[model samples]
Target: MTLRIRRRRFGQIAIATAATTALSGFAQRAFAQRGGPILYGVTLDSTGENLIIQALNLATGNILPINIQRRIEPGERISAFTAISGRFAIATGPRMALPGRRLGRRSRIISSTTEEIPEPQGLDNDAAFESLLNTNDNNLLSIISLNQGTPPFRFANVDRRSGRVNFLSDVDLLPNRRYSNLCQSPRGTTYGTSLGPDTGPVLVQFDFANRSIITGKARILPIAPLSYNKNLLVNDVADLALSPSNQLFALADPTYEGTNSLFIVNTQTGEMTFLRKFAVQKITFTR
Candidate 1:
């Protein structure tokens, strides 16, 4: 909380200043009006040394910059983020903290303290949280853990106010499968991306209420090869966000050469249509 963006050299500062001035208009509009579905995510500064939160208007393709910028600490990186109600939560490794800003206002770090989620029994201490979702209940956040030598990933709910974590029962159906980019619909349906046995990347649904995988709905995604580099194929979905209207957007994993792409994913047919170039590290939908 309240982390500052590290200042850069004189030359870099000049460039950042110019960029900031250019973005001032978008910021004003973002704070001034209530609009359609907005996608929020973290992107690196022009210097690639600081992280800036941005809001994208799906209907108008306008990008707005949040006032706060934070520098990544040594060996630390943003792993998960979600925006729901009037608040947003960000996770850097095992720590989760709420930013100070409410919608339509300049952001501040609300609390000076960041909460660390305790690892469940039998889970490797090194396993960190990889995904976060806003559930129907505003008081609870759904979380998924990264598998580090573990067979099945861990699922749990974190109490937003008390910092309490309640682990769900094991999902035995998805043993040895690696899933990431977890997102949920307004109806409490959870979905994530995972690799298929032969077809490559696929979308899998989970029934959190029943603690079971919806195997019948899993479908292999028809991801296309990179336009610039035909040899490079997208191996994973870096992030996923679902709108209130049920539109699924996906961020394709950056290539080894560092090309980032975004797409509109058809959940029923597993077809992905190219949208545009994307630079965000994580994404979530907010109204």
Candidate 2:
């Protein structure tokens, strides 16, 4: 049993599901104070080898399509992506075998400069799959590698202003486990899920300013497994998003199960509250 979902480097798609609880009033007030409506962007799988990227207004549920007229080829498919600074988005495409090479693959990152126009700006990069991506309030891009081998993970920061990419160090203080989901809270703390031996579905936080995980400060938080409904079990997290008020939202899926679910967890308590059972593959929040 294999549950296959979109695997785009720095890009993903979200399929809507049924959930009744509306956005919280406190969250709404937070957005209002931020001076704009909260908008969400999603990439929907469409017919043929293409994806439809669109933006949704969280306040009114109004959706605006960004790439309805664009044609995406197989190698050009988006693997993972995130919106940055409320004005632009950065996305990565599928890995491709370098032509005429013995055995090598390369991935690329592009930016959606404007929602109205689908033209993307390509950023320079070598051959490595970008597994995770997130942006801070200052629009600084954070990217990490998903490749599994010697020095399995590497972190880099992309300066949006100068288009300069800088490799980072000193994050070895974090658990040496694979991270499936990563997001930044409004206050600038980085949170991600670590799935590894002895770790279980653990939520890990890092203080970028301090360049270390808040190890001694917070207790280990683990994501609880959902009871399978008709073979639906959420054992793996596909993606994560953080609200302006620092609420954590996760799109959890099983390796090979019937259905997926959305969960909200409080980092302080390490308790996860099941929010809704939906088929949404990925989700993110912005204001």
Which number leads on lDDT? 1
Tell me each candidate's TM-score.
Answer: 0.66, 0.60
lDDT of 2: 0.46
Those runs of model 2 whose alpha carbons end farther than 4 Å from true positions after fitting are 1-41, 54-72, 93-105, 114-134, 137-139, 146-151, 161-163, 173-176, 197-199, 211-235, 255-260, 269-272, 276-280
Model 2: colliding residue pairs: 8-79, 8-80, 9-79, 9-80, 10-80, 10-81, 11-79, 11-80, 11-81
lDDT of 2 by residue, 70-141 (tens): 334554434445655433343444444467743222344444432332322233333232434555544444
Encode model 1's per-residue lDDT on 1-287: one tens digit a residue: 11010111111111122222323244435545646667776766776557676666665565665644345453445667776444456555533323772212111112101332332333344455567776655533344544432336566666555555656553433655555677877766667766544445567676545422554322323233222222323476678888889788887754553745567877775667777665678887754
Candidate 1, after superposition: displacement of residue 48 in Å? 5.0
- The RMSD of every model to the true structure, in order and in angstroms, is 10.7, 10.2
- Give candidate 1's whole-model lDDT: 0.54
